[model samples]
Structure formats: structure tokens, C-alpha cells
Target: MLSARQRQLDRVRTFLFGSRTHYGAVFTVFLYALLIAIGFVYLYPLLFMFVTSIKSPEDLLNPMVQWVPTQIYTENYAKAYRVLNYPQTLTASVVMSVVPSALQVAVASLVGYGLARYRFPGKGLVLALVLATFIIPPQNTVIPQMLTYKQYGLLGSPLSLFLPAAFGQGFKSAIFILVFYQTFLTLPKVLEEAARLDGASDLRIFLTIALPAAVPAFIVLFVFSVVWYWNETFLTVIFLEGGVTTLPMQLSKFAQAYENLYPPGVVNIFDRLNEAIKMAGTFLNILPLLVMYFILQRWFVESIERTGIAGE
Candidate 1:
């Protein structure tokens, strides 16, 4: 018994210095620590926003109150809602984000499926062009796009944005196409062949088998598309202009509105119009995204794993 115990201790010491087991454990610990640090870095800003948003004017003014507020200021949310014109902006944001996401998802999926399953002349060139297009920053084309939209009197219309996405030219659309392409490429050829042997038409097989099998890809793309569209400010300003207002746009306008509402001449305004209110508006702007991520985080993880299988 003593010899067996002595051998186990010696093995453990040896493993710690020279074996994969201890090295793996140490590497995992380091990775976990690194992830936790990164998580904190990303989350700290959000945490500050929530905390600052819930603070009352008095609590905000008090430098001593860093983490906890003396009193919760529920009114900040009400003020933010009013400032943002929440109902109207929320509706516009939903339309802007969801509509483009749906259109882009459908179009990109078809394009990706075709690229992955079929081979033809110029296929490689087409894919290369797509990837190259992604590298060309949107800023270069903004002038031409604006001029074209202006020529058609679509400067302030959502259609200006929608039409581009309908044609599979939406924001970061090439990336979504690539994602779907990679996912489709990972599917087993036997399943497709089996379906074909059963007299399944190409379209029917794609809709019934290929698409259904790539649910994770769809979910991942949809979520990412929504996020990109939702956070988009530059394109929204250029295309929709004043015609549509989303939460992020609303937040940008808040500072101007604040200065106008409480000019430098105003008295006792320092306590009311502070960073807390600005942060409150920011919190409201991002709340929907936070809710969405929490709800679909599981699917996101699965998608990450599945997306990597193509390279493997």
C-alpha cells in the first residue's frame, strides 16, 4: 500500500514537470484566467452603464458612491424612453434590423448553397470577387451610393437601404455568404446523394435537407445580421437620414438635445443633466441586444463549433 502511494506521488511530480496531463491542466488554467480577464474588460463598460443609469442625481453627484447608489433612480429610464421616443424608434429599429437580416439570410443562403454544392466555370473567380469586395471599405462607395440614391429621390427613405440588401449587397453580406458557404460545405455528401436517388428535385432537396441541416448556420447568421444592422449608424445616417430613427441614432442626437434643453446658462441643471442620463440612454440603446444575446447564446456556441468543422 505504501509503495503504491509512493509511486502515485512520484508519477504526479513527474507529470507536473514532464507529462502532457499536468501541462494541459496548467494551459487550461491559463486560458480560463485569460478568458475571465477579457470578459471583465468587455463587461466593465456595460456594468458601469447600468450602475450609472440607476443612480439618482444626488447619488451621481456624490463621488463617494462608486458602485452602489444611495437610491435607485427609476426615473432615468422614463426620461430615456421619452428622450429616445422609444415606441417609434423601437419599431423603426425592428424594421431596419429584422427586415434586412431576413432578406440577407435568404439571399446569402441560396448563394452560399450554390457556391458550395455546384462547380462551374468562373466559380473560383466569383468567390474571389466576393471576398475582395469585402475588403473594399464601404466608405469608398458611400459617395456613389449617396449620389445614386439622391438621383432617385431615395436619400431619406428606408428603401435606399432595403434595396441593396434585397440584392445581397447589405452590410457585411459577403461575410454571411462565406459563413453559409463554409457550413454547407461541411454537410455529408451521402445525405444529398440519398435524397437525389429518391427523385428529390434540387430545390426540394435544398429546402428540405440542406437548409434544415444548417439550422445552426442560419441562426448564427440571423443573429449577427440583426446585430450589425441594429448598431449601424453611418449607413443609417447616409441612407435613411431623418426619414428613420433607430436607438443608436437616437443616442447620437441625445447630446445635441441635451445641450439645447439645458443650455450653459441654465441653473441647477448640473445635477440633472449629467453623464448618468447619457449612460442611461446608452443602456436603453443596447438593452435589446443584450436580451437577444442572452436568449440565443446556446445556439451561438453550437454554431461556432459547427462552423469550424469545415476547416477540420
Candidate 2:
């Protein structure tokens, strides 16, 4: 009976503490708890924003209301929608982000492929320059670029944003370049050699053999580029301030725009701009980004896995 009890105790310990083959029940519970804690930390702000956005003015004023509102009030969204000029600004944002992202990805891929696959004069210098560009703050270059754009009459036009991307100089272009470079470096060169032996020209070999293998990298970079471009406000304000208005651009000036739409003296105090309305605007500003992220989340995970940088 003593030996049997000892064996039962050992089995229970093993079940709780895990074996070489599998995790234990305790570990699984702890891991899930940690994940839930981390998830809450990241999701709290979004939850607060969404809840606040739907709160009525009365709920906002009521001290009793914190996480949950008494009722869902959508008036804030209606007011915010008009203040943001959602339809027009959303279109502009999509154009601004997608166009530059496509151009940036294309340019980065070529630059990365060249850096990874070729030996050239001043290769070290070129790489050093790309890294330097990545490290350098955009503030240092924005004024000069703005002036140049003004001089060339490209200011406030999409070309002002596009030209740099087309030349592999878009915002965070260096990172994407490095990503592709690393991706290409990992690819087996034997395929390229085989293509070459088959009488494929350099460009043809790259197009047929190398580019297809780097599709995952391309998707990852493009998605990230789109997010960066979509969220960029500083350069957009400097270059496209007068001519175009993106969601971020409009969001920054939400208060002023709200006043313009509904003057304080003309409207009742309850109808005036409030935190709920501001939260609504903020939520609207990020809604598209959330949608995009959710839709492409699987692609992002898969691409990251394929790029072999998931651990990184």
C-alpha cells in the first residue's frame, strides 16, 4: 500500500510538472494566464476607446459609468463622421497608402535583390548609406524635401510622396530593403545558377527564379509599408497639407473641424463637442487600420513564417 501510494504521488507530480514529451497542466494554465494578461494590456486602450465612443453625453457626465455605458448612443459617430469627411478622406488615405506602398515595395525588392545577389563596386558604401538613411530622423530631411517639392511644384500632390518611394527612399525604405536582402540571402543560389545554365538572362533569371521565392517577403513589406504610410502624418502635412486631407490629417485637427461644423454659441450645450464625440472620431480614424490588420493577419503570420524571421 505504501509503494502504491508513492507511485500515485509520482504520477500526479509528473502530470502537474510535465514530462519531456509534453507540457504539464500547470504550465499550460500559467501560459494561458500570461497570454491573457498580455493581451489585456494591449487591448485595453482599444476597448476603452470603443466603449467611450458609444457613450451618451449623460453617461460621460455620470461618475457611475466607467467601462459600460447605460445605453449605446450613436450620435457621436454621426457627428464624427461629418467632422472627418469620412468618405473623401478615406479614399484619399487609401490612395496615399496603397500607391506609395506598392512603389516602395517594388523599389525595395530590386535594391535588396541587387545587394543580396550581386558583387558591385562600393557595395559596402551603398549598404552603409542605406543603413544611415534608416537611422537618420526624417525631420532632418523633411524641410529640404518640402522646399524642393515646392520648387518643383510637386508639393500637395501625390507625386511628392510617390517620387521618393519609386526611388527606394520612402519612409522606412531601408528596413524593407534589408528585409528583402535577408530574405534573398537565405534563398538557395543553385536555382539561379540552373536558370543561368538554361540560357536565362540575369533579369529573366531574377524574375523567374528569385522573385517568386520572395513573394512572402514582398507581402510582408507591402503590408507594413501600407500601415506606415497610412499612419504617417508629419510628411503628409508638410507635402499634401493644402491639396489633400487624409484620415490622420483630419483627425489631428478634429476639434477645430468639429467647431467649424457645429459652432458652440449656435448649438445647445448638450449638442456641443464632447469626449464621446472625440473618442468616436478617434475610433473612426483607426477603424480602417483595424479592419486591414484583421483581414491580413493570417497573411502576415504566414509570410513571417516563410521569411524565417518569426523568431526574430
Poorly placed runs, candidate 2 (over 4 Å)? 310-312
Per-residue lDDT of candidate 2, residues 266-286 (tens digit): 999888999899999999999
lDDT scores in order: 0.85, 0.92
Q: Which number leads on lDDT?
A: 2
CA shift of 213, model 1, Å: 1.8
Estimate the TM-score of every prediction: 0.87, 0.95
Model 1: CA > 4 A from native: 1-35, 194-200, 259-272, 309-312
Weakest 10 consecutive residues of candidate 1 by summed lDDT? 16-25
Best prediction by TM-score: 2
In model 1, the number of clashes is: 0
Q: How far off is residue 24 in model 2, in Å?
A: 3.0
- The residue-by-residue lDDT of candidate 1 on 204-224, one tens digit each, is 989999998988778778888
Q: Which ten residues in a row have the lowest lDDT in candidate 2?
A: 303-312
